[model samples]
Target: MATDGPNLASTYEYVIVGGGIGGITLAARLHARLPEASILVLEAGSDPSTHELATSASTVSAVRSNADLTWQLPIEPCKGLGNRSSIAQVGKGLSGSGAVNSAAWTRGPACDYDLWAHSVGDQGWSYESLLPYFKATECVRGMKINEDHHGYEGLIHVVPVKANWAKRTYPLRKAVQEAWAQSGVDYIEDGNAGDPLGLTELVEAWDEGKRQLPSKSFDLEGVDIVTDTLVHRVTFTQDQGHEPRAKGVELISGQHINATKEVIVSAGVYHTPKILILSGIGDPQTLVAHSIPLVHGNPEVGNNLRDHLSVALTWKLKHPEIGLALGSPLLTDPSYANGAPLDFIQFGRVPTNLHTEMLLTSKEDKALVLRPKACHTESILLYTYMGPHMSGVNVPMDGTYITTVTANLAPTSRGHVSIHSKDPQQPPKIDVNANDTEVDRHILREGLRNISKVLHETPSGQSFIDSQVPPEGYPVLLPDSKDEAYDVRIRDFGFTLDHPMGTAAMGKVVDASCRVIGVNGLRVVDASVFPVPIAAHIQVAVYALAARAADLIAKEQ
Candidate 1:
């Protein structure tokens, strides 16, 4: 129920801030593990299952501009993007970003999680340790699930794109596959098998033609959910012989709810660290500047922020009937060949020659170089116009355009999320130093060129392309341009794919179990705790992390 004013219950065994995927999942798991424990979940937004803008799968468009469903938080003017500022579309309701995001379910390469485990000095954070949780969280449907690699009974249902799901045949599907094959990328049988290399059919968190938001899928029966309650800061109790403990959370209404055992912060990438800093658990200088007393001095709380930067290339289709639009019947039918539409995604590394040149020439770029064994770029085929509307480019609404969204999955340019004011309601200042390093620009340039080659140079891809509609001043073909021209074009068109992570980093701010380093009874379980950004869409990782976190918390209890 919606809890407002000062009448909130004073005590609970656990208090979770932000009822997003992480919070809701943790609460459900906690309830399952500790049947009698009283759990409280405070959400800043309304419950997603009942919210008007959150009910429909097509609400992805409305959620971006709807203030009631999203934070619509703006970032500081990024110097890398020609001093341009952009709004971060973060879901505000119980389901969080999962409710509004394109339900593409992707688990990145095994090495990505292995690297995280090594970086954090925790074997529990390794891929093998997290695999069970990953399997347990997904109930594979429609697609062929490798029995050894997938679970039969899970909370979220994963649906693969079937031919019947297409309103009409994606005339270019075969051509695109042929193009990727021509470009030397192999077809991956399963993208969720910890090896997301080459071309693969897109998997989504869908069931019966509807998006399964975590708030609706997971069971939160035993948890006391308090909606429309903004947690101002975490309340702490310091004992002379022990580390400071999180006693409870103070609401924006000045009401305090006690957490007898522990408090967990799952307020997402930006707000997670923002709450920590507001609670005096961040950099001492920041707390002092806000005239807030310091509880713990963790300078890394709001630092080391990272996100996937994407660039779009749109092409006019020769046949409009072959393309899928937003309201196509093929998209909303579960009985369709697969369950969803628009499959086909490719993950590849930038050319070795460019990698070598960057390593030899620039120190900054050298640090940002894509590891030879790692996949640094993701190219996904879309049957509809997919460029960011904020880019000032008019996307064709006549349904004759197809776009290729290429993203720098492994970006080296680190940014941060810092609080601008002491008010908890004020959004954090986000600075995702996108395209700052030469390596990022170089990767995007190569990625754009690679996709262009697949769609234009290859025989099958070229057969379907009627014409191209590049942004103003952008080169007709990226590969033909000089490095300077490519860099300018990248800076002009680059935008966030909304996969942000590493603000309250694991190795730095929290432990392997996601417990905050210098505090007792306070842990962070969300995207903010990731040591680095994963190569895949983050929702899958968040599910695995939350499941693991729930197990860890249960063991400790």
Candidate 2:
């Protein structure tokens, strides 16, 4: 299945940059809507041959495997994280991050979409307008016959947990539900059904125990896909010095692929803004400093960078089964257990009553929720995901740690993404400035405290936990609490969710229609255009946005 050459070397009606969820979803939608139009996707990295790179926790692990799917570019050092420069993770192959993400596809509360639409002044962007497209991307498999929020037929597969698995995670969840009820927050059957409150089982993207890819499901035969191609810059033609009309895209290899009607930038938050700045459509001051000629003076291009900061809290469990290792040879061995882990479970919650949830847990559970800030800030929990197995931690030879991680899904602090140089090959400067906001820091602290409470509530609780973080009870932030020092202790250990968004904000840099303000034949359809980070995981929202963009682009064409 080696691709002989660029799928469509020199000509295409549409050229999409970045083949991740955003790009692939649009590619599929375009083929379904416009069968005759030729589409080309340019990815900078190589195709990942194995799912390991796609599923690994470390960003570098994803890029290491596929030479054709990942190309390491030198990023100018970031100022937020002590002036140390690091490489940013971007997809270079067909499935993009869809191949590597944790695969939790949760649609954030509908309120987020409504707010986004209002901010952008687009009537077509409300939750109602976007729901159909959400349905279009999902194929909910094996659900209750009467499940209304689930989809019947769609390209991507949605797999819920099996009966036994759901039962196992139920106790932990039930404890939390009981706690939330005491706090006066009612539970809902489905989080995606308009209101997201209380405990809910997350919907994952999987088919027969493997990750789902949009290319296979979305494109039965119509779309032309290209991997190993990087879009260096967007080519444009100006008319009367008004809005610039998109012509095509220039590849990293210097090949120019034409976009007959329009070129949509579906790269995710990091690369979308990078591409914009490289194309000369960003903050003129930053662009000028990088020595790049300004194409459009949109100062908001890379500002308002926001992401959910995540930290892992771990504990040693009483039962070894609770911390069974999926990657262990006994479980993952081809001949043993059919390559299934002894125990792998996930339970989700939409924090409606944050205060009471924190108060219910023991001090040890609080540590699991939010690690003492003075301890490892990079991770928040001390998880006993696996222990004392024949294989140590079941980790690969690489530097990846096979432990559980939890991120504060909503962060109040905002950051920025700016261009370091005019060169597309050069990575953009990413300044998350994480935890700078006291509100975000306090929220994370509260969230950790709540999770810790859940850990100590039942047999499902501390039984599987190996150790408690902070070696002390949960950190307290209340005004009357005598432990004022705990507040300072919690702030020191905050981490980044690695989920950045809001650059090239919807109403500010781009209109509600996703069209770049003051520019024509150009639009940003990636996560960058999200005015604010949605309350749930970002992957689903990115796909939904791409689907919506395809509709807008097709109508105009």
Candidate 3:
């Protein structure tokens, strides 16, 4: 809803910036607990509930390409990816990335959250501690959900692709499963139970084929939602002999909205730190460079940025009818071949000979290398068309190609997000620094090699593959190509899985309760508060985190 002058003049008990997944969820939870409390939400983009692209489950491409629904931010040229600059697509509306993402509702392994809790020295953040919240956010449908693992009463609906639909759409489902089994990968009964080691049908946050946006799923009754508004910076006040307390927020229009109780910043990874930096709550050096006076010297505000660096390997299908062509009604499952369940995406591995060779050639630090205890690589098969549409090859209508996207799940390489100027309208400088370390490159190279091997050597995989279709401007690596060739290929084609996080990290920028360090009455509740990147699709985690944050905030109040 549009905000008027009168709305801006009124003060609220709680002010939430960004109206995205975390912000909306927190607002709904707070309202449910304290029905008399007044809450205000400021969103930079239009409401996704009314937008067609945001609500359509089949229009995945449209959500990514639509300029109006996404913040078309560009990353700074990275030496890791051959000094190439690429667009970082962050959602711009009320639903945020949840509205635009591929709708894969897989929660990562339990070990990932346990590791996170250990890293931050907080038992409350552990998987077991947060399991109730995870269950509280979703109502599983269309499948027999384990009562011990899933919730029966929740707003968001989670469901598996129907068996009839999967059978009709994926003619090669059985063959693919057999092929994966032949390659030594087992079938996971349910990926969400936290053991995602094998092939499992993906559950999506969809109801009746329509995207269930977080904004719509969460009840926003009695909440004042201000859409098409940009939050310039948070306002803070310091009384005599008292700590600096957050007053509210100032808009780009120079209007002030007062928050009598607290201000919660949930502007996402890229913009959450951007807002904090703009408010002078960043590194003193960065603030001085941008002529922004330092309010607090939290050097870790925008550092430790992490994301899944991915490269796609495409192949031509000999039997087009077996592929997900003709706008298939369902996409069955994606599997992880050889890695821990904590690894975010599904992946396949190469033969033992190639695997040994790749490991022998590696010269990275032993600590950085992924061992059996830690997950390094991840992969997932895409049945539908991928790559540039203008290339004329691998078109959805043509039904000739399938793609496998491989990635480094637990990357040691780190980057930062900083502002060039004090203007919030200008996008932040996001440098993921992908493949900056030898270990990251090694993992990605091996991942690509393994996926290629599965498609070429496996009986079921080979039966469907006619040939490999390299994207234009990419070199086709021979089966006997050197390891350097695979490295070069990864550098040339790598992109983010679009899961950017760990900017305002926990235990550094914020405390265990998500309250910002060195500040009172202000908190950051979003992916930015993640101390480390969780190895999975992040939406489910975000929902669970927000649910936990709401409880913490409510208890303290």
Candidate 4:
């Protein structure tokens, strides 16, 4: 069962590389549709069932830190980010990042999808076109859900912060809501229901409190799941004046598996492009630089990389005995031990126009950001002192502080995922240009300023926040802080939100059908194919996307 896929057939109907979320989910659905078809899934990571730390929210860092379970790739220094280098890591297990990420099941605004369709020149990628797939993927049980937009019959279960029966509450739940409202952000019933702006209850892809692994949730009972197997590159059968046809994949260990029908690559953002490039199907210049033989030359294969970047503000609470933070007596209760600590996520545009700000953004990118119903910022309220610390504020083991990590959801800064070697075993060169554009910097600065104003001036804020832990040389923020101060802060300490995509974008590399251009019998179905940045945590979108890809693949057959 481990060696042979679907049967003992030497050639499979579908050969899937990287048994991560997208690969596993697609295989499960395809198997359900065509029970007799031969499908092979190759994963370079361990089986998630044996990964003990993947079940709960508390061990997320432990899972990511486990070298055996994750690919901790070093990022190249970005000049835009004050020349600071950071890590770009993701899960290497069968479930991939879905097994390691904080399981927030959020769907970005409908406009995000609509804009993607417009950019990619395909109506099928629109929100209305993809709505059925979204409904097909989730069994939403939130308290205030609109039945018209949610589905009760799906594999993954979604629960909002105001969930009726889940029986869990945070100490700062009500206060945090009131404080954000005091800052003029309104309440929205369901953020997943097309409208993503304003403050909304936090939601998660949860089972009571346990994390849901995609490899387990989608039901791949009889499918062959090969683990710890690295795919080196795709072997193709090509002829002159014809698109190269993918024959099969060659493993890094020099083992080759034949694919009779198609080869699907879902190795994710960081590694997917590396596989394509290693297959000699990328930019001519890059191939020449790495001394790889060129089969198909497309410059966009590993370009246009983007991710969510954030700057966090830490607030020292007045009363530690109240037990509002983590490490408090409140966590002793079993209900509080599961899922994420925060209760709500606040999203909105920058408070003011950037007329006074310096020149920023390409004309096309700027228009989409300023478009109607597109949110530019997301503020995550962590119930503990999880610091993106500028001052490096340290507290006791007691609960005395909380953090707000406000991220630029629609960043204009673009980076690339390039390779310096011909070997796929070596990780790709990842350069994330954080806070590079003036537009990105302006949005983040104003977002921090807005939240800071809320905690510093609002009546509700006075109830909970004692004071902000300041950066060095400043006793307080606002009056002392300047444009250069925050710019310096962002360059010094801005961190990636760990959501990377668009390396193999739809409009550039693949068509709307997810088929790679200038090649046949090869498709990429993963977050790397996302043409634009979706403004929410990508967990829900990825699950729903694989469902869409499976449907498209099945219909073609």
Candidate 5:
């Protein structure tokens, strides 16, 4: 099940593992830096999808489940969450998750990059230093001065939505502005130039009228983008004194890849640390428990996992007229198609070092505040072509399957990733530990109340009239008043699974350079390396992190 890779076994200078955005982007940079260096990228996914219809959806349906891109499922059950672990939905294809993710090209405040550098103690990783790279990869559309915040000419194409769906979704931006006005925050038209305090329409990665694929955006020639090849282990050779030096990796089918210069690990957060531990480079206790020998005793390898926990506050729309239903009759008309329905009311802020926000606060108010801040708070975003016209009034069990979801960025609770087995096929134990930190819970509690306050405003009535499901009927954690109990009930069941970050965190286990501590020739360049989750959607930041890492790797060479 392996594809032929470029002939780099003879004179290859670098052999990168994983061909996601990070690997491909780094290959481009590496090609520019050491043009003469032969680079081979080993991807465990398919080449790329060319189906235009597959790229138009908002959820996982946008992805084509080809054998080359989908990897083996998790081996067995995990210890956490009552041992009911699910299969991780990450992309294994050439472009990786970027190929199937909702194409929202959001860049949080510049402070996010600065925070990353400061946390890892990496010199020159501040926003000022990395701004050029962020701007270098972006191609802004729709707004003037996009060049000021985005790159006018870049390999990846960035386009704006001009359909009716976008227009209907645009009003949510105004609603959030009016909501946040009560809290005394200023608005910024562009969130990428730093200072993401207010509401703005997000920019997404798309072509002139469609989404862009990594296959088309990257330089695929010469660079061997091998798909459907699963790397089981990083083969290491002991040095003169028996120290482990990562030489290369071995595929599942028994093909050995030898690295001439270096074997860069960009297998993302979940697998990166798992690979290190299997290679004997994690906590001594964890290694011993899993019956694996220890290489370096870094207790922090799987610690410090942070994610932006989201809680949603959904309501049935009073009239189909408030959103996208008004334009339903014109779907067949070419001049009026491709429009977005629901509006977004997202928010974010620094985490408080408390135990939990939802636990300490009243329920009803929690639901209200979450409507504007905690869950889906995007400064810049995209309007999907999908419409949310429900055929009936049945409430969905899936918290956000068809409703508005608000999010809380910066959580105080810390989760962890641990290997259940030493086998490469086994999935790591990923317990989100959501709502464990009082500080994080409090933020959600407060955020919910704020949003509830805004929904009571004049313009908001058009959307919420006869649409809300009251919290008064909730079984437990009931509040005395309508507002008090609203947020609490929402907190109890309004959980979100988006924005998982930190597993193999930077600084503690991996150094400021994203290199795993005490390990040679190994590095992480994904969401796992984030010391903490940034203030916006992590997808763009992950790309930026890869960009910074690529430059660092080049400089080291």
Candidate 6:
């Protein structure tokens, strides 16, 4: 709300910090089930309604961006990134990263979630068990998904590109399909059903031409929403020699809001653990260092941070005047500006021989064993020029560029997000540890090569493409380029995919029901609770997770 308002309750049954998707889902579900239960969501950022671009999909930058809308977190120098640090765009508004992320609704493979159930020892967390929750979140009408795998009357609107649909027939769609087919990557009709191991039509979280904001997508009536408010720490009502029970939260301004029953932390990956640490729920040594008396110590609170790091490799189209790309006269139909400019998304793996050659940890081995054929590389196609991805690569803005943004989906690299101070306002230190292992570097390099193979070696690609647009000092890296050249491009220009997770990991920090270990009446209900990295856009899985988390909360009561 514009202000906390005079009618705010002195105490609520539930006080949730961070009104992101998780907060929204949990509040909406709980309130709907128990209409009289008092619920309050404290959000540090303002209402997304004030930001027009938060819901606009007219440009390639549809990954919602309004500088004032995010927590501009900084990363430390990484040995893998050639000591170059990049800024992490973390969403701070009510919808969280869903407000600032590339809105592709890719749900990843079933193995990604099935493995979670195996690792966490919770059969209920398996893909089959969680299918209903997944179906409950998205309204998949007109899209041909696998049998019994989706819902029709869900909240989030989803639509896939069809050849006959208006403005849906994008140029290069045929070329991309034929190119991948020629490259041995056949097409898959449904990427969200169980697996997405091949070329699939790009499905997004947009309806026709507009993307719906989280508040519009979910039912959150009669719930109190306090915006532009910061949470200082979770307060506990304790008796000595026993675990503390969460009473409520204290705001950054020293104002106290009480939760009679429970307090939930739905802050994003980076900030959730920071809040926990500030609340005396982290490692005792660290809490002592910060001069904060400890209530409970959980060393794993801010560890095991995992994320996807990607890089853009551009290719200049052989023909620009033909008007296939954005900004071209022939494409000025306005309808073409509807969703993301990309036509298709391909998920595959690097050469298996390369993966087997590297020394892997026990965790990586077991994860691979469960996800035997999990996607390791994901490539996104952009119809317009993305030349600014690299310096010295001078290309005109005449719409001659077609880019392939590739990411390492199954990265073995593990990072961390930790608090350096006791202050809640200070953002956590995020070390994504991009390309930390040789395996990750090669996965990224080969991912780029896989995209390049469609162009450099395929007949369909040669029909429309000309040459690679490499940085000024380097030669164009081909599909069979040496490991050294691929390494150079990756180390110099790799960027975070902005999909971070694993901080307050499930098995380590929270129990199967998302309850914080060693504490009472407190839970973590966001990506931070994910035990491992999900190999897709993540927002879909997060929504599914929220649905299940809400159910779990209801059952416990």
* C-alpha lDDT of candidate 4 relative to the true structure: 0.81
Model 6 vs. true fold: TM = 0.95
lDDT value, residue 352 of candidate 4 = 40
lDDT of 6: 0.81
How do the residues 392-484 of candidate 5 rate in per-residue lDDT, one tens digit apiece?
Answer: 124433322124345567565666677878777766666656656455555666555555444544464344334444434553221123534
Candidate 4's residue-wise lDDT over 186-205, tens digit each?
A: 99978888897999888888
Instruction: Summing lDDT over every window of 10 consecutive residues in candidate 4, give the lowest-scoring window.
Output: 1-10
Error of 2 at 113 (Å): 1.2
Clashing pairs in 3: 344-535, 346-379, 347-379, 350-450
Residue-pair clash count for candidate 1: 4
Sorted on lDDT, highest at the top, how do the candidates line up?
4, 1, 6, 3, 2, 5
Please provide, for model 1 over 236-273, each residue's C-alpha lDDT reduced to its tens digit, 9 standing for 90 to 100. 99989888999999998888899999999999999999
Runs with alpha carbons beyond 4 Å of true place in candidate 3: 1-6, 162-168, 326-373, 389-397, 472-480
Q: Tell me, what's the RMSD of every candidate? A: 2.8, 7.6, 4.8, 2.3, 6.0, 2.0
User: After TM-score superposition, what is the CA distance of residue 104 in candidate 6 from its true location, in Å?
Assistant: 0.5
lDDT (0-100) at residue 529 of candidate 6? 95
Lowest lDDT 10-residue stretch of candidate 1: 332-341
Clashing pairs in 6: none
Q: Rank by TM-score, highest first.
A: 6, 4, 1, 3, 5, 2
Give the Cα RMSD of candidate 6: 2.0
How accurate locally, in lDDT, is each candidate? 0.81, 0.59, 0.77, 0.81, 0.58, 0.81
> Cα deviation of 348 in candidate 5 (Å)?
4.4
